[model samples]
Target: MSVPENQQEAKNKKKRKFEMPDTYVILFIVLLIAVAATYIVPAGTFERELVDEVERVVPNTYAQTDSNPTGFMDIFLALQEGMVQSGGLIFLVLFAGGAFEVVERSGAIKGGILRAVNKTKGKEFLLIALVSILFALGGAVGAVANSIIPFVAIGVIIARALKLDAIVAVAITFGATFAGFNVGFLNPYTVGIAQSIADVPLFSGMGLRVIAFVVIVGVTILYTWSYAKKVLADPSRSLIGVLDEGKEGESPLDAPFTGRHKLILSFVGLCLAFFVYATIEFQWTIDHMAAFFIIIGIGAGIIAGMDYNKLTLTFLEGCKNLVYGALIIGVARAILIVMENALILDTFVQALSVPLEGLTPVFAALGMFVANGALNFLVPSGSGQAMIVMPILTPLSDMIGVTRQVAVQAYQFGDGFTNSIFPTSGPLMASLAVAGVPWIKWAKWMLPLLLMWTVIAVIMLTIGVLINWGPI
Candidate 1:
């Protein structure tokens, strides 16, 4: 059965076509690599001392420990362990999904976005800027990454109304959030944690950080707006082309912006405000957040006139939609689990910090920034990374003539900016999942912005070193 020439050529082309790996596959590959590294990378540890009931790594005390290579059975065990460890965050994502679904069903989000779209028809830039700043401020104030998931739908509706794409939707919301988070002027998670460990005044280095925030956020807004205009002019240019084919008729514009919609949205706004206040004031954890989201769903459902059964079913359906995204958080955590079980995690930190000792102060500061960014891949938690690395880097900073403030700033820039692009970042994966944007698609679009931010970070750190930025 000899194939025709054209058909044979077509078959060859099909065989050669590249297909991006699924998110789970990519994560599993990372896990496999981590498991392999357990044997290859030497196991090591640092002495820790308790300060204010927190464990921090002791500097200049790196000890090579016995290798604890992960076995094949441990590979499967790590998955369960990772899920158990990340149970709180996973539940938070599911609750948020269910809550946002109830709100969407009530027409509140759609109605409000439509009204805003109509009002800003001629001035789209104002809408973009306003949304970016609000989310950026939320990020600046220590909002967790998963907190942005619930609001992505609102951004999507506003973006669609203005003929923009999903990338723009993510840009104005998630992108802006990370921009402020990376600058971290008042970010309690990264800045607060790092400063506390470094013995610098909490939230002390604000002047330069404020400038970085404005510049980074401004650049994000302009970059997003420019891409949006292009997508508007030519639909073919969209990164996620043919936006939401099945959802094209799902726009609730025909539904009038009723009193119930207003009431529902107002309650949502109040809930968000109170959520922020409680998070900062009461130091609420993800469990409290999960419970609060359930309240939001039930309240919104009742207000929307849904009976108990309908509400329950709607909530479950919403949870179902997010199952793929939610589980990914746990799977991504497995990578860290593998590293921890293998005891190679601290070795990475020690290796990264050693090179900085030999560089000039300015370059050393920049190297710290670069090192933190790399460490973020394995240890994604900002506060956790601070607890591990700050103890070592703080004293190293002093020895090398870099200010503690500058070291914390480097940690902030390193830890925050890479979250958007890293496949291991569960919140970023979840955000893209909710928006129906693939990881590869978002990465391709987000890399340029990250590069720009990197350059900005370099300039900022250089200036910090030059000025001896400190309150020491």
Candidate 2:
């Protein structure tokens, strides 16, 4: 090991080819790390008490128990639980993707989008505003988690057509949804669930949340439009610029809009409207939404003049295309299952609250924001995290003299914003995959915007506490 030889070896290492790992590989590593954590991290539990017929963790009931290490076999058991737990979400992704494929194949979406793009040619910000508002409202009221999955591909294509980058497309679509969900004025999954746990009136404390939503949505629009203008000015500067084919120069519509296209587009719009209405008003589960999509696909196929054979095959093709995204959702769930089987999920939640107990009211509220943000990695589901953390968080907020509404709002803010950035988030991953953007590239591009959102979130949380945001 001469010094010259060591230097030569280092040079050789530097020349080694850098290959970005597959998304599945990264998730698999996370699964193994979680399994390792089960052994390394102490086992603990919290007493479960039923409140309002829903099981919840009793605050201050945490206790370290004898280690019941998750064996290798337990990993298999965890996988099974993950599949069972994520079965509904996985199914929704596949089915909805298939339905959207049918709609896309009909050419209605293309025609309508092309016409819309033509109208907004010079004023691209108007297009961004319109789309952002729609998606944000979708996130705010519809709890549209998997609902956005099917549209990511179309959004990317539209972004390209509009001379924008993949990041702008994501911001306009998922990013807007993330903003609305982050504010969560009427989001049933995060806000509704947390409010229920806190014993606050459902959808109460809307006054401040509405303001937060508008501010966030406005910022999202400005940020996205600014990026869009940059990319439009120089296509090579786009985050996905290397992958961009300069599709902006291509005509979005291969042909003119027809009567059939108009009818099909109208049908698709009505279906979307029904989806939002059904979700907000009737509390439609993912399964119900999937069924609705299935019906839409079949009906649209018929309207578009596709024969029975072609329709079935198109639907199947759509499902096949999304198989990777759907499986990732289930695989991501495996990480949570391992934690659950090892009984470390509660330990993770309980341990976070230790420091918050000592902080002042405002800082404690802020601490809650940080805690929920960190926990979002472990449990990405809004409703699931609300169920897991809110029970304990609600009582802790009360103990520290922070309003329960503030606690719920913190949870909402924490859970929603990270979805667009976290790799472990299935929907985020699925959307990236659908848009053909690499995780590393997307994360790098989104980091600055995420930091901006973080600052805004802090201000929003402080305002909530200062104003005593509540229906307590």
Candidate 3:
């Protein structure tokens, strides 16, 4: 081969070697690894105590029990159980999909978004920053992540209309929410549940969390806006490629915005406001949110002047579009199920904590951050992870002279930020599917931002430890 040809061949070989496996395949491999660990790592359990009507771990109560390595049949059964367990989340995705579809078909969503885009014509950066912060605030309040799923498709459409890529859409929607969630400014899922388990007053360390929230969100806006400018400058630079396929073809704004579109969009805005309010006041679950979306869809269809029959069909079509993304939730849940059934969840936590035994308080807090990130891959649910991990960590933090608040901070940071990159995360996968972007592309795009978030996390954690962030 000629020298240049040899170099080209070598590049192709390297690319092939680093290629990402299919998401399903990667998940299955992870399940197998979890199964193997069950046999290698000793099975264990932590005694539980009822704190504030919730089950929490009794610190230092971990005791090894008999090994329960899952057999092939057991793995299959676990997968089945996982799907059943994830029924609420799966249904939420479907309902939200159907609901958003109804709105889309009615043309209200696209029209309003396009009108807004046109209004911001010369200041697209302002649009990205404002929308991201709005989503981030919603996430900061909690129960907004699942609610935001229906809006994922809407976000992608808007990004394309604004001359950006699929990555920007996911970043502004899921990524922004996650950053707010990770910083944990009043996020009930992570901070509430975690602090409850740790026996700290609920939201006791709000001052620190507020500072962290601003820093994280500001960095994220700059990161996403910078990438968006690159893609706009050279359309070929877009990771999603030309997004013309499978869309409504002509610009949605080509049709003039009408009074009907205004009313419909206003109704949706009111529904979203209620969603946030009721979620905080009533502590609404996924099922409640799902039902709310269904109601919104029906109302939107009626207001947009769709006949009953047409509305029904459009709603069904929306659900059909989301089937792939919904199934990703069920399949991902199986990873947790297999680990839970094999009784390795607690064992892994115990093993990961062993190294922190002799470390200084500052290092121990940092170690907790690292361990929580590792644990996040196997257990991605924020509240679920908090319930399982916090009890053990609270006591560990005390022994190392790290405040319980810092431990909760570490836990939230670990559980929140990694979701954006982990294949096991249902929301991340679903959002990517909605945008037609591959996990590998999203992960590669997210690496720098993730590293920056980690640095922010470590720095905040260190400061918390030094300040003796305590409300114990």
Predicted model with the maximum TM-score: 2
**Model 3: residues with Cα > 4 Å off, grouped in runs:** 1-19, 122-215, 221-255, 357-452, 458-472
- 1-472: candidate 2 lDDT, tens digit per residue: 4579889999999999985466567667778998999999988887877756545567678898876677888787777777787676566656766777887788775566556656675677898787778678768864345557666765776676676777777777787888888887755446765776576766667778888889888988888888788887888788777235554457543556789988987787788667656655675655676677789889889999999999999999988976875676566677777877787876776676677777777899888888888878866767656655675677577556678889998888788888879887888888887777789998887787788888888898788788777663
- lDDT head-to-head 2 vs 3, winner: 3
TM-score of each: 0.66, 0.66, 0.63
Q: Could you say which candidate leads in lDDT?
A: 1
Backbone clashes, each candidate: 0, 0, 0
Comparison by TM-score, 1 against 3, better one: 1
- Model 1: residue 16 alpha-carbon error in angstroms: 4.1
- Clashing pairs in model 1, backbone N/Cα/C closer than 3 A: none
Task: Order the candidate numbers by TM-score, best to worst.
Answer: 2, 1, 3
lDDT of 3 by residue, 205-314 (tens): 77789899999999999999888988889989887774553365655445457898888878877886676567556766556767887998899999989998999998
Cα displacement (Å) at residue 386, model 3: 10
lDDT score, candidate 2, position 460: 80
Candidate 2 vs candidate 3, TM-score winner: 2
lDDT of 1 by residue, 95-136 (tens): 777887787778775566556556666688988887788678
